[model samples]
Target: MSPYSHDFETLEDSLFAMNIMILISMALPLLNVLGYFLR
Candidate 1:
């Protein structure tokens, strides 16, 4: 039970990291478009 809980915690952390990465990936393209329009 303890090991399973530990694994679950790690999985949650990884999922959080993945979400952050996905947001950044999405933002980069939008930022580029904004910059191009501003220029």
Candidate 2:
């Protein structure tokens, strides 16, 4: 495999991971508010 393709693959993987982290960070605050209301 070419080094360029490998670098692209790594970039894609990191971008996917970053998206997941952003989603979790966004959800956590909403979850906390829900929990507070339910308590």
Candidate that scores best on TM-score: 2
Strongest candidate by lDDT: 2
For model 2, name the residue pairs that clash. Answer: none
- The TM-score that candidate 1 achieves is 0.81
TM-score of each: 0.81, 0.89
Give the Cα lDDT of each candidate: 0.99, 1.00
Q: On residues 1-39, what C-alpha lDDT tens digit does candidate 2 reach at each position?
A: 999999999999999999999999999999999999999
Model 1: lDDT equals 0.99
Q: Candidate 1 — which residues are off by over 4 angstroms? A: none
Instruction: Please give the lDDT score at residue 30 for candidate 2.
Output: 100
In the range 1-39, model 1's lDDT, one tens digit per residue, is 699999999999999999999999999999999999999
